[model samples]
Target: MIRHLVLFKLNDGVGRDEPRVIAGAQAFRELDGLVPELEFWECGWNITDRPIAYDFAINSAVADGDALTRYIEHPAHQAAAGQWREFATWVIADYEF
Candidate 1:
């Protein structure tokens, strides 16, 4: 199993923080149906850290490296990611377990 956790930091003046984060969460939620190897998917804001930490985060579970690859390479995911890159800092990490 692998827990592919990622955090996204947004650039300044991109948009209102909550709305941008909500849009990202909605976008990530779409991957569940589109990516076969995506066993589980969730997204949320970093409330405790407030304005300090990354704006939002994603939690994904995959079966293995191959599964992770599928999720990363899926066309739907690619499209979603392309849009995210316009506003985000960078992908945090792919945690394999």
Candidate 2:
């Protein structure tokens, strides 16, 4: 399986409670059942108050590179990512485990 991890940092002026941020987060939370290539899904806000920590994170797993690609290209995923693009920037990592 491949583990896909994402870490998000909100834009300089954005807040977690802002409607747009809330909605974007909700969109991702809803993707677990919407994308067929997502075999596992977990996401949430960061609990730490450190500068190095990202504001949000997504911890997921898929069958392989192909599955990971499908998950990334899925419409629901694309839409959710688009929402985040307006208020945050993120980094991702994928590895076999």
Candidate 3:
């Protein structure tokens, strides 16, 4: 098994960033159908204080490294990530089983 976790800090330079973040979260949360290896999906805003925490984050579970790679390279993921470029300033990760 593999746990793929990511955190995102919104650029907030664009006026529409909040909505984009919400939409992106919704899209990613619904990716189980698009990627068969996806075991679980969760995303939300960060209202707590953590050393490296971002405004938004996602924690997903996959079958293995290959599934993780497939999830990252999938077209549906590509579209979701492309939207991040406009509103995201930083990303953090911690991937392990």
lDDT, each prediction: 0.77, 0.95, 0.75
In model 1, what lDDT does residue 93 have?
70
Off by over 4 Å in 2: none
Output the number of the TM-score-best candidate: 2
Candidate 1's C-alpha runs over 4 A off are 17-24, 49-51
Error of 2 at 26 (Å): 0.2
Tens-place lDDT per residue, model 3, 1-97, is 7788887876646543468767877777677677777788777778887777677777888987788788889988888888777778655464675
Better of 1 and 2 by lDDT: 2
User: Per model, how many backbone clashes are there?
Assistant: 0, 0, 0
Clashing pairs in 2: none
Candidate 3 residue 7 Cα shift, in angstroms, is 0.1
Name the regions of candidate 3 deviating beyond 4 angstroms: 12-17, 49-52
Better of 2 and 3 by lDDT: 2
How close to the true structure is residue 27 of candidate 1, measured as C-alpha lDDT? 79
Q: Candidate 1 local accuracy as lDDT?
A: 0.77
User: TM-score of the candidate numbered 1?
Assistant: 0.81
* lDDT, candidate 3, at 87: 76
